[model samples]
Target: MKKLLILISILISLQVQAQRTSAPEGPGSLTFWENLSKHCGKSFEGEMLNASENDQFYGKKLVMHVRTCEDGKITVPFHVGDDHSRTWVLTMEEGNLIKLKHDHRHEDGTEDRVTQYGGLSSNTGMAKVQFFPADQETTDLIPYAATNVWWITLDDTSFTYNLRRINNNSPIIVKFDLTKEVETPPTPWGWED
Candidate 1:
């Protein structure tokens, strides 16, 4: 009887573990972006300048804010220039895949440049971001734009950004790695350290 009871307990534990790791449906599917939103209140300082020029906007600081809404949409608000602020929406798609929609606009509600398609891949603590080609009608607006992938690592204190340009014809492409500075205190208002 003792051995049978032990086996039953083990089976129950295994079932619970399997459910914990199972993929959820709908809004629950965006677990990756949900985790990222936890860092919204905290600010990460980083810079992304022209890849070729490098010095044109070197040392310029940018703030990254990740906000997760109640409807399960994650918004990443990024400031590039002094007066430019862009927000990207991260949501889950049909095949358990994550999609990021870039909504770039001016302060007056005019669309500046919108790339409504982006791809996301996450495993463990690593993430990959891929920006898709712009829409057909808006091709002329963003001529120099091409699809690019960025590899990122997220941890309790900081995040790393590794950029890569993807090309089908080119044999050689460029890659750059940038680290963001994050300051997390020992304990915040509502949570324990």
Candidate 2:
């Protein structure tokens, strides 16, 4: 009876540990990350809500693919028309922070002159929304656009990626409806076909 009791206790402890590791964090970014991972291996189409004529995303068939995911990061390729040169990278930072970076590459599998510019979340934005301000690298890369801020909102109906440029007022929003999952698009530049 004593040996059986010890074995039961050990099993219970192991189960608890497993549950704790797999459970999603709450009231902040962890929940959002887990929810975002739910759509892994899926692709969605987005439309610019307010884009200027000069915007690269303007008048293009915008598609986002959650292509690569891991324990601490997810890489999503954002396609604009035939320009498969942009990717969004989200990384888990210490202290409950989340990092967002824009990775751009060329068709010949080379890095672009302007790439890997993004920011880390400054607060626990919850499962509904997350805001990423331009990091130091972005400030150095594009001094004039240092004030760029990105806010992502996810809900049952839609997932919105909104960008606020300099002065944090001019909004360029791109939103995707969650109910409609589209066929996967082609691989982005520098990726295997």
Candidate 3:
């Protein structure tokens, strides 16, 4: 009887461990764009307040729109109170890191700003954004590149984006917290259910 009880307990423990180690299904394991597609027909309203210190555009309201695309892409259109207009493309890459390409443009077709190559950190949720010189001949742009750390969290109904600008020279730290706007009618949006 003792042997049988011990065997049963060991089997139950192994089963529980297996279940715990199982991977998450659906959006959980899907690519960043694929996960965003789950929010199709939904809208996520949030503000991108400026956290830049010693800048006149501090505390400005920057609206964000996260729209789903059929080609598996999340279009994040953002405007910072007439000061800046840009769009960030978020796509999943190998090793589960999200690739980010930021394009700052004016009303015209000309490119006002460009981030030659930007991507999210592989191990962290922080954004590794960089700015390059207009001249393609240049090989390095580290002196001009700005690194920003950002954190994102999602609940069953809403999501939040917290961005902090890292100061490489000064001791002053800039931080911005943005919470999704909750619709009264409870529209389908964000990573919420």
Candidate 4:
């Protein structure tokens, strides 16, 4: 009876080990998405990394707030001075593809004419960087913006939002210093008052 009990104990231990090693994991690996999601509820101040003197936000206060985060999605709202109309929605698709979409709204809580435009990364970029080319939705929304390509980067010190128009010399860059968490701005335009 002692030997039988020992064998049963070994079998139970092995089963437990196998279950621990093989059980499912949460949203396998959207590393870049995961990295960005880590800053939920934090706000950071940013400036244009490379900008022309006439840039829209040249002297405006730019802030980005990682407002909401869930298992497979995150919403980051970017504020330009008092304009609270831009929110970036990032979703982790079934296969772990990261889809970025811009949700723009008016102060009165209405959708904007030129909004919901973005794309998915062509490959599985590491936690530090990811590049997304203009997707069909983008092309359909804005004809001239069909060639847009965006670069989203994050590191221990900063988070950057960069955009390039293919075959066009102009590129817009917004780099936020992540070393400090700034005061949270007002709720975005479409959110509950």
After superposition on all C-alphas, the RMSD of every candidate to the true structure, in Å, is 14.3, 14.2, 13.8, 15.4
* Model 3 RMSD, rounded to 1 decimal: 13.8
For residues 1-193, write the lDDT of model 1, one tens digit per residue. 4554475359446544654666444343344455566666554555553333444334444555554443546665554445344555666555555555556666665665454534454322212222223333333444444454433434345544433344422211212212443542222112112
CA lDDT of every candidate = 0.44, 0.80, 0.42, 0.80
Of candidate 4, the 10-residue stretch with the lowest lDDT total is: 22-31
Could you give candidate 4's per-residue lDDT for residues 38-98 as a string of tens digits?
A: 8899999999966777988888999999998988888999999999999988887766678
lDDT of 4 at 1: 45
- Sorted by lDDT, highest first, which candidate order results? 4, 2, 1, 3
TM-score of 4: 0.82
Task: Kindly list the per-residue Cα lDDT of model 3 for residues 84-128, writing each as its tens digit.
Answer: 446555666465555555555655535654443344534423121
**Model 2 per-residue lDDT tens digits across residues 1-193:** 4554475359446544654665445656888788788888888899998688898787889888888879999888888888989889999998778899999999997999899898999987666678899999999998876988887877666778877675444477788877888888888888774
Better of 1 and 2 by lDDT: 2
Positional deviation of residue 100's Cα in model 4 after best superposition, in angstroms: 0.6
How many pairs of residues collide in each model?
A: 0, 0, 0, 0
Instruction: Using TM-score, give the best candidate's number.
Output: 4
